[model samples]
Target: MKIDVHGHLSAPESLYAYKANLLAHRGAHGRGSAGVTDDTLRAALTEPNRTFGNQSHLRHLDEAGVDIQLISPRPYQMMHSEQAKLVEWFAEETNDAIARTCRIEPGRFRGIAGMPQSMETTPERWTKELRRCVTDLGFVGAMLNPDPYEGAAQPPALSDRFWYPVWEAVCELDVPVLIHSAGCRPPARESYSLHFIQEETLAVAAMLSSSVLDDFPTLKIIVSHGGGAIPYQRGRFQPGALRAGITFEERMRKLYYDTCLYTRDSIELLLRAVGTDRCLFGTEKPGTGSTRDPRTGRWVDDIHLLIEDIDWLDDGQRKQLFETNARELFRI
Candidate 1:
């Protein structure tokens, strides 16, 4: 069972709904409309039967040797800056779309809900929605934007006490939270790849420096995008933690990482840093762009092939990375 833990849905109905709501009350929302136009978004959304978990997506998954995918809304669609009511509505709609997709083939798709993370949203509010997704909707997990303020206002750090309630909720529910960054507020932070890396790196560092993990000891956080440069910067963090009487590596062990790094060397580095038990297979397929691999003459977003190419990992370790870890973490 090769489970890809990172995948995204671009639901047109939800997007159009949010766009209409955002446009109707222009002054109420903080962030302006950006990115792909409605036509393009709709065109992308209308792809065959599978938006993320449909037949087309499953065909690709079969080609990549992926048995299942934990699907969530695209990060850009996680409109964290809209009014709380609208944000909640959008989240429900998005999660419903994901549920719909998963319904197409339960064996091939599982759901990860989107949260309503506006500035006005309280942890109690998050807990409510999370419970709805998990208990009623049959979702396995959720995506949380630690910085929900987006372009509207400065947001609290992931370590802030403001997020404690949400952390407690996740611990109580026994569901992992995929700590994904959303919405590029500042123009300088507009590049999706660059912003994702920056925010994920910062989120990890903040969690390390704070007591949130210690407080909710069983809480699971799977950082996306190969932990966003965290593995490469171990020299900076590990040594500093040693000086501060802390074991950085031990702290990082509590969290999980996905294989979305796009290269053999980067995945190997992550494997060495976190070990097989803490890493899961993730292609970000159909969402992440592809390029040709000169060696194989095949397009390269198929991360399963990349994992297979790693010469050092034996069959057992490969199983752990590709399937066992996800099954245990998401309880699928």
Candidate 2:
């Protein structure tokens, strides 16, 4: 069974309506409901107008040769820089909607929660939502935004003691934390897509340089979008300017990577850098990769085909990349 580790919910318009109301009232609405129902979900997913979605999320999964997908809230739209209460309310509702969607199709989908992170709040404070999603909502894992304040200000690095609360909790809970960044609001920031790359590159560099993993040995992290230019530009981190204490590649292997890179060449580089055992299939389908690659007729998010095209990969590597790695990390 091929399990895609990276996916975002194709939520109903009604669920997003809650965001509109919350923003309109500036959280004075007292945490509005998503108003999501199965029928609304069906219409939103299967309908022709998805903003960036296909006719159906399930159909995209099938077309991409994915059996199951672990889905989280759309990271770009999460609005992590909003006020704590407003962010938390929206996050709670999004997780609830994801749970609701997974329940509708237990075999095809699983929930990966989005934490309500805001500027100036302790990371541990949001652990309650992480715990709720895992224990109460029966989620498999969660997406941790290392920079919740976006690009407005410098937040604590992932290796800092400031994040100890979250690290300690994930270690005990035994769930993998996806190292992804939320929206970027810096006046001179690059496009949102490029922002994901910048944050992930910084996260990998910082985590490797510090002893975060040594402090919590059991903690698992999956760096999305193929480690965000780190693997490709390995020479920049070759133990000269930045010291990871250990060899850069060895430290990199300690963390996991996802196959969300848009090109086959980049995915190959990541697999070579981190090895297949430390890699998992992650398409991020219906996100930026929803569009078709002109050279190939299939959508860019059809990562299974991309991996299949890599001639050097053996069957064992293919098996690990497509299924084994995700199964072990998620414990499914």
Find the candidate with the highest lDDT and give its number: 2
lDDT of 1: 0.78
How do the residues 5-55 of candidate 2 rate in per-residue lDDT, one tens digit apiece?
999888887777788888889976587588899887766556654544444
Mind sharing the TM-score for model 1? Answer: 0.87
Q: Mark the 10 consecutive residues where model 2 has the least summed lDDT.
A: 46-55
C-alpha local distance difference test of each model? 0.78, 0.85
What is the C-alpha lDDT profile of model 1 across 11-115, one tens digit per residue?
A: 555356666766588537754433334454334434544433443454566778878889888887676876787777667767776776676567878889888
Off by over 4 Å in 2: 241-246
Worst 10-residue lDDT window for candidate 1 reads 33-42
- What TM-score would each prediction reach against the true structure? 0.87, 0.96
The best candidate by TM-score is 2
